[model samples]
Target: MNNLELTDNVSAAAKRDIFELQKKIGAFSNDEGAEEAFRKYRLTRGVYGQRQPGVQMIRIKLPYGYVTADQLVRIADCSDKYATGNLHATTRQDIQLHFVKLADSPQLWADLEDADITLREACGNTVRNVTASATAGIDPDEPFDVSPFAQAIFEYFLRNPISQEMGRKFKISLSSSEKDSALGFMHDVGLIAKMGKNENGQPVKGFKVVIGGGLGAQPFPAQTAYEFLPEDQAIPFIEAVIRVFDRYGERTRRHKARMKFLLNDLGLEKMMELVQEERTALKNKVYPVQDIAYSWKNLGERVPLAKEEILALADAQLEDSEKELFQKWLATNVFEQKQKGWYGVSLRVLLGDMHSSTARKLADVMRQYAADDLRVTINQGYLLKFVKAEDLPALFKALSQLGLADPGFDSTADITTCPGTDTCNLAISSSYGITRALEVMMKEEYPDLIYNNDIKIKISGCMNGCGQHSAANIGFHGSSIKNKKLVLPALQVILGGGFTGANSEGQMGDKVIKLPSKRGPEAMRTLLDDYQNNAYEDEYFNQYYARQTKNYFYQLLKPIADLSEVKDDEYRDWDHDELFKTEVGVGECAGVMIDLVGTTLIEADEKLSLAHEMLAEGVWADGIYHAYNTFITGAKALLIGEGISTNSQHSMVKEFEENFGKTFYPEAGDDSKPFSQLVFSINKNEPTEAFARGFVGKAEDFLKNVKAFRAGQLAENSIPALQELVYGQDS
Candidate 1:
């Protein structure tokens, strides 16, 4: 679409946001400090810097992976115009467009907004896209549709103040049934639909809540927070937990800032106590989720063929080899839904990358034969819903033409991988390269294993686990081994991790050994060979690993771990001819740390300005939270000037009082209320206009005091690193 057409399609608010982003980008081109600040801001808006300089990757949020045909076409157009003519479907069910010039991001965003799609809060420290089971509405075993609840949470958190500037990114997922198809066990907050009896013994709707789970450098399994929390209380409960996390979660140590760490520190019981303490401060005590009216657009009134007739027609049309392959595809890729006469067809996009032209074709196919509802699966595949059973053959043929009709959907052959050395700044090795090699090996050598759905293989370029390696039955993440003077890229092999599915628990992978990156395919072959020979009938991969134990696998793969026998080629990383040299860049996944005192003070002024803007707009709660951050930024700046670095805002407030309270207010001594008490008043009182104005006034005074204090320190030349302060220091 042209600029005018795009502008006409979006709301005035979205247009303003895109224009402001363009203005900020232009400003940053002239000022390096402004670039650092804008980098953080843009990430929250879903524009992320790729590993390559001067280009960006824009992540588009798709709640529950639901996309209309028109939206897909728009995405394809945007990819063709602004990106590399490709869309990468992420494990989180979001689509990423890579290799776009930074200057074009605003235009790209405007184009997406034209289709009612968004890039806002798709990355950075905000609550990410709320994911749900791809089979939410059609699952036979589901108690109720989880789409409404997931959508509700997505709407509630979009532009919500509580999570906009969190210590780290937050993830929430809703599962349709006990099957946990959404992989709820590995998210920050996981909700599984449940049916329970109220006090009066009537059936009530609720969720089985799990909290604090995460897969990163260190993986943590989520713990149960509630056996059955009434559906209406879900939002309030989540908001309360977020408030507690915002107030107390670590900020300085990026690696230690996840909600999982807070849960680990406080324990589940104590964490729940803190959550309860914040209940009174929540914006809503009970947010009843209204049932969403979801309708599938019927392509045409074509009569569905009977099962016998469909089989007969397929037999007549297919050649012997084609029929055999079609049977395998149907057995592995097509799902019979709860809806009679309908099916869910899964297309495995190799490594989650689909060319723009192919995507446009897929959209056309959906509009012609399916329900026009396309859901991206968590395993980097596409699930086309509500296809007539008879239409499967035609759909398969069309998908085959587009190279998407692969057999294995979520089986071992359907490997999950992250954009490692391909685009991510923190990736130390080439995950995509190794993943391609492994997939080829599996299809060519272990073709019969395509139907094995019990085992999963996942890979990440690093231990950050963006590929969710920790939750796989067999997993690998990038690493390195130093042998004498040579450093070779390596893959850390992990085993025995996977979900048991429906009424069962899951386990995180145990690290077994590290092997050269080139030998990853060989290592996979060995693991599969051993499993085939030793496993009992129908024995799952994790169960077999548990019986054999970690030591056994370590011994089995130990030969490959011997660096003394490494060849010259072992020094090379996958997809690169040059010898491996780890060039890990600073990850902007959680936003960069700002350490310059002056820059921090400038940020405080910005926060104050936002506070005033929010208050003027009558968003009292958001204005109060912004004012609260203003206080934190000013205090942190003063503390940094004193070389007294604190990890969290809570600590910053306490340290400020301890060091400067007596000097600033001599009479109020130890008997006075702590500075935390004053700054944290945002949650103590109702978020009314009077309170918002009062809080903003207090923040203004605090910023003035901090600026004056810093000026005096500069006059005395007491602060160190006057001109050498780095803007992105971690601590």
Candidate 2:
């Protein structure tokens, strides 16, 4: 899409409004006029898709999942600025604006660019934004600070050549504590901090490395690659891990590109054998840099405070009635500092939001109470570190004014969700909105039920499973199809998808339950109420789900499902398919989140900056990344409106040649036909849409744009670095 020097489409859409705004641009061909289209592609944050006829979707990138309060304001503004005032947050932490006209992406990008947010790395194969503990530095229990390293990696990896054309997407995670909230155990490479007595018996910090963990068509847990690599060696250690993955990973299978599968197939002994040799050689090539690879940075000067500060600040922050509950939440949710009088508190938000005036307030509050530092966690939570006891009360009040001092600090509402159905073309359900609605529903209907520790409700828009429904105790995956004679909306309800420190891939529920039309929010409320009230003693949400299959849930939910009076039948959610089956895919949560070795997140950054992560240093080939990419490419072909059973004979190569540019000279096969074409082929305006009845018609146009929406996963992973230079936009 980037080949165009300028966009001057000879065949463009007519702005003339008709009784109905409808027209066919014909097949999106890269034909003679392709260059101009490519030209416009560069200036715009997104391209057009035909998930349905006469509709388009726009994607916005959020680097490393970092969006400032101002940027969110920009999102709210741009939503008003163009299309509709609605934004969708993605599993990748990117935001998407749907219903966008094909002609408006440029202005949208220009507006977003004004806020230093770029749609560039939002998709394509580019190095994605670096993620870390939202509670970094502020968590007193953290052994090392990870923000610097995550930032450095984000800076270094963006547009780097070696990273750009990765055999498959490379994911790296960094965490500083052992709480394992970041799920470091399930990433391409996970770094966890291991704090203990060193040989000298004094406090020391370093990492416990885990490699090759991912979830997808095939799920695998990350493994320990190394232990006790001092804080200093973090950069070289990660570089070594990358080299191991890039060199020895699989390349032939679309289902096997992830590093986790590699670790499983090769076994750690053999994997390390390859890595050790590579590391030895790399060290020799970089003399001075190699020498500092094992130094521990956390042993530096400690930040101290008075003991009275922690007590006073926390005591002062609470309202009379909320003080007790707030204190308990704080005790469990906040971290105790090593210093006598300081503490770090977690500022949790619903689905990664600290909006508008609150953003400004939080920053100010942190500055006043904290030591000018904060950490962002992959879980979309924030941290305020080094607060004196005296300031805690006021800080809490300030945060409460911002509507952020919700009691769910570590409670269920401190949830993580991807923007689904609302904006993403790939999305099938409204994950976050629904999550919020559900949270509220539970609060109103069965507040005490959710207070129990074991139940967590997670939702994903579609099969890509961004919301991680497959891992939640009560998970929801969005899907659509028609019933005997009607169109409908539905969610493949999963009962038991759980992830804890002990195991992986929680039990999945069965049956596709219909969503309530006007009372969709009420439908979830019913399910939650039923579960909360009927749950077995000591049974967590997933455990209860395991006891009852999706079939049972559906049977229980049939009453609510039958209540739909949706006018546009197509928008009605129903027609349950084999959606209840639990199938996990190979997807890493993002590396910057899982890999923490020592409390310092930036140690890797300093090390990477100093040693420089080289392309040749790591030979990249992973079966999973390749498989996922190829799967997406193949999936795209099937989506092109055809007799698309699991098994199909026809292909879309003919259309690919006419539509996609030479860069994507699709071959005559299922794998070669770009998926974008298949999605665009969907007929949108069909009031009696056949795909999923009215629901597909209501949302089909959104689906067609899924392929075109990949801002960083497909094409942006590579960039030619000038020996020691790095690239990326920081929030």
Candidate 3:
């Protein structure tokens, strides 16, 4: 049997045993007297700071996780052609892409927009992507069809005036019936639509509300803020809650500002009072909703379908592929149709991502294949609803191009990942990066890991928990080195994460190992190595990691192991003390982000061991600023979350300036004079030309040979437009 086939029969315990079975599998060759390794970048993926360098988390709206087959085809085409094709299905029933280059984002976004889909405030600190249940009218457990409400909210929130400016990012989830696809309690606001009664005991169809729930670094189990409100009041009530958050929520410290935090501190009663006050004020102001007909579900109208035509085409015209296969798909993939002879077919996608080459060809096949329509699911899957049985293989093959065809849906390794450090600025560790590494590792170590339904891995780059790592079976947070000399990054590797319609909050895993700061691939390998040997039968990585004590795992990894010269050795710097050390004669080094797309967001990236200066463009280089932004947002000082005491020292800048003498900037042309020497020359009170350091630090052109470098000077883009200023410097 091939290696892949060989892994199927091995007990899971054997996989777990492999992790602990070896003490030192390889040795890392230390380069004695060599240069040091440093972490590369960091950034956030939210809207707390407009234009902050962050991952542009695009949420493709899936109304009830249902899209037309054409929509699905376009999504697949875009996935491979625009994004990496590894689309992630969010619990909210949206698809998210990572590694999206900044320049291409607008085009990619336009694709969705062309279809009348949106990319309006998926990222940034606005009302984030809205969520809805997977099963709408068809679910046996549903109360009433909520596809309309979900559609309404999506339409209303797109660049809405009031929704754009929020104190903290907000999330909204709705259940179609009592059995909701989304974790209602985990959202900032939960809405359950139903046919109900009002306080006056009048029969009404409306929504039941639950407010103040969120999951992140600070997980809060949302409580029911309001039991029920009439149907007409749902949108207004939600608006009121959001306005209250904007008015009362803390803006300076993000951690303290989640609606739940505000609700908790104010107490639910007080929160309701405030909500009432906000609602009253909003009533006085003009509302943005457009009222349309609502019939508790078009219970009487029967939507007709081209059923006879579909049967005529399928029964006689299908000349390719297997007929029995098509029949079976019709049985398993078809959904309850409101229209006669019409049905929705669900096509599960494992891992929420698709390959491009596969996606493009699928686009062609979809146009010619099954139903001409499809839909996306929140489960990181999609549905080719409204399709006839005869077109199943063609639809399947087209999807196969996009790699969306995974029959073993919801099994292990169909893991969802939040755009990690690879693209996100706020992530603490490289979530996607590690995911890539772990994918290879898991496939190699246990090819049949997915076949065993017990395992899963989810990751978020930072604590805002965008990937919903909190609810994954194995959750990983992005992290970075607090110190350049340190080997380990600050990681809170959580375990015991899970999600379900019955119970939603997944316990966070333990910090078995710190990320090796920037060495994402290496850190992932270590975690996988540990997982291979320690797990048991029917034991997924999350459960095993949760059950084992931190000490137990630490002891196992304590001994030094030999590694290849290429191995990442983040273990050198793991403690806080190593991160912050004071020394004389050695001037401090710092990096900060000046602009991201175009705006000031965070403070300096973790202090670099050395600072660079570019005369061609003032002091800071474009590359340096890019690198700085990556680390800056993730540094403990920026997030300053509410309940979590970061012990960050952002305001200590004055103290820092006082302790370290303002250093001099460097010269590009001179190779003999290093930055340190130039600083020393300035410190000795030497005369020199002046310069700028991108508005962050003090800059003195401490070099004696500045004239030669400036001789080939490049004109500033902005300054060139000022005719009089450029001609005379306004002197």
- TM per candidate comes to 0.94, 0.58, 0.56
The lowest-lDDT stretch of 10 consecutive residues in candidate 3 is 34-43
Minimal lDDT window, size 10, model 1: 722-731
Cα lDDT tens digits for candidate 3, 374-444: 44555566654344444545565455445555443444445566644444445544455456566666557
Give the winner by lDDT: 1
**Per-residue lDDT of 24-61 in model 1, one digit per residue for the tens?**
77778776555567878999889998899889999999
Across 1-731, the per-residue lDDT of candidate 2 in tens digits comes to: 22112123211211111100111122133242233223222322244342343445556655435555456566767776675665544444456666676545555655666666555444432344445555554445677666566655555454333343233556666665775555565567766767756678887666777777665535566777777666566665565555555544543343565667777877889987766655542322221122112122233344554435555656655668766655655554555665545667776667764444455556667656765444444445665666655666676667767766665554554455665554455565456656676667666766554244455566666755666665565566666545456544456655555553233332333435645333455656666667768878766565666577667777876776663444553353333222222222222222111111111112223222222222122322121122223323333332332332221112233433344424343354645544444332221211121322322222223222333332223345453231112112330
Q: Number of backbone collisions per candidate, in order?
A: 0, 113, 63
Q: Give candidate 3 misplaced runs (Cα > 4 Å).
A: 1-112, 177-179, 193-195, 198-205, 283-351, 355-357, 360-373, 387-398, 436-456, 480-491, 500-731
Model 1: pairs clashing at backbone N, Cα or C within 3 Å: none
Q: What lDDT does each candidate get? A: 0.86, 0.49, 0.48
